[model samples]
Target: MMPTPGFPPSTLNTEGTPIWITDLAAGDPNHILHVVRGIEPAEALEVLGAKQSLIQACELPDSTPDERTSLPAAALGIEPGTSAALLAGRIGEWTFVYDDSGFTYDDAATKALSADGRMAATSVYTINGDASLTYAVDGEQVQWVNIDDLVLEADLPSMPAELRAAFEAAGTIELEGFESGEADRQIAMRAACSLASLALTLSVLRRVPLLVVPLG
Candidate 1:
């Protein structure tokens, strides 16, 4: 099991960090996959503030219990210096999606520079859990152009031998049970881990200039 030499971060590419991608499950109506992303801390707060201010400004009605929209920390799913994404990563929560649907993580990338550390622009992401997702920058959400639609996708070379084998194996048919169906479970478990690793690798490599390879 060789390790993927993770994707490049902002420092490597004159452009920026690479992105991870995967297609929606079979027969998924959208025929799309989500590229998990993060956002910088300062920018994340700025975006949130703008949305809060805007939403707070609107009144409910002319006279019927006309309460204003409150941008309370608890209300917006924000904390004194934390967010839903942070909570979900550290401790398994019932939900990871925010009101707008962003998943946050402390070290969501293979490299420290690439992972969101409460400041980097890629710390918080808005996932639609399908193709065509958005991420948070403070409060405003931004969308990633589909990697499939990118001219870049065509240029990406095959992932290194170890990683490519791992990715493909995840799609392999489950082996029949020898007993408690443990064989099939093991296959799925390994596959899930492989995919996670692949995502991190893709996120960094996707930024390489003049680099492209089709995984489809």
Candidate 2:
């Protein structure tokens, strides 16, 4: 579906229905997007073990592809030997952690972030065509899926009904006759993220002043 004119590029349909979790998957590969429920951006960073002292505020503008990829680090004056860089911001009730280097997909970090009545979900898509979606709650992993193959890698016995329904709708549950391609993988990822009410528009992501944290 075409994003509305003048509106930030979103997964929303013309009728304002959110069609996907995020558009990042369709853009660059080798990116990881994490959403944590009911937490401030700093708190999310803390849970990920990023030092607050190294966090810098930066404006990521919606621009050309080259600029989009290089601007964040440039704006932050990222130093040499920086092992990881993460852009963090808050949207609605969720705090989003974005890493182009795909370094934000730690299972243990997800579990830690989801502790204390919070929920954490992450979508990772690598340039090698590896993709996964994971959800955790209260310091435990509740669901994990291999998005590239549309397989349920792991799940609890009492999985959330909403999540099960989402998987079914995305055709990940019944895979005997299911045929999927890259587009289908994106759909599956979107369904998984939608369960957590996570959606980020490119415009919004660029306009927001995000916290840039560099990790060793």
Candidate 3:
């Protein structure tokens, strides 16, 4: 697929790393990316049930994704792979949170994240080739798509017209056979992320001083 205009180019940072959303999605299969509009990173973390003290004290030094994942466990002196860390950063009015270890697809959590007339969307890609995108607005799920289940439903009455159109244009609302290759699946997942206005890349992740919240 050709790069979309207005989308950030593959090299989105000074480091010149050719990072794109599809690359990240394909490389890291078991991960969740949450994009919350009109909220600070700290507020989003709090909405996800992270304690304020822990959020304040658990900012890991800026490091590679691997280091970030293991540093939290080492710092807390816990068994490796036992602690889950959430990395989040703010861009404009949206705060993006990346969870490489687990998924937060709980209804209550999604609603809470979109409370107070906010908007929240999450894109989850599992290792089993199942991918999902959930969008909530003002505490209600407005759009949802599960690739593996061939489910694509948008609350047209409540969802913004632009978003609905974006989904349609990106083929997110079209249900067909599951993508067979990892690259194809990554492209599909990246489309979902794009609909939620999440143009994340590894360079962006590295440049932004993400707040690391350790979940043990």
User: lDDT of each prediction vs. the true structure?
Assistant: 0.24, 0.60, 0.57
TM-score list, all predictions: 0.22, 0.70, 0.69
On lDDT, the candidate that comes out on top is 2
Tens digit of per-residue lDDT, candidate 3, span 67-102: 334433333444435656666777777787666555
* Model with the higher TM-score, candidate 1 or 3: 3
lDDT of 2 at 45: 81
lDDT of 3 at 154: 28
After superposition, the stretches of candidate 3 with alpha carbons farther than 4 Å from their true spots are 11-28, 56-80, 149-160, 165-184, 187-192
For model 3, the local distance difference test gives 0.57
Q: How many times do residue backbones clash in model 2?
A: 0
Off by over 4 Å in 1: 1-82, 87-110, 113-157, 172-192, 195-216
Error of 1 at 149 (Å): 5.1
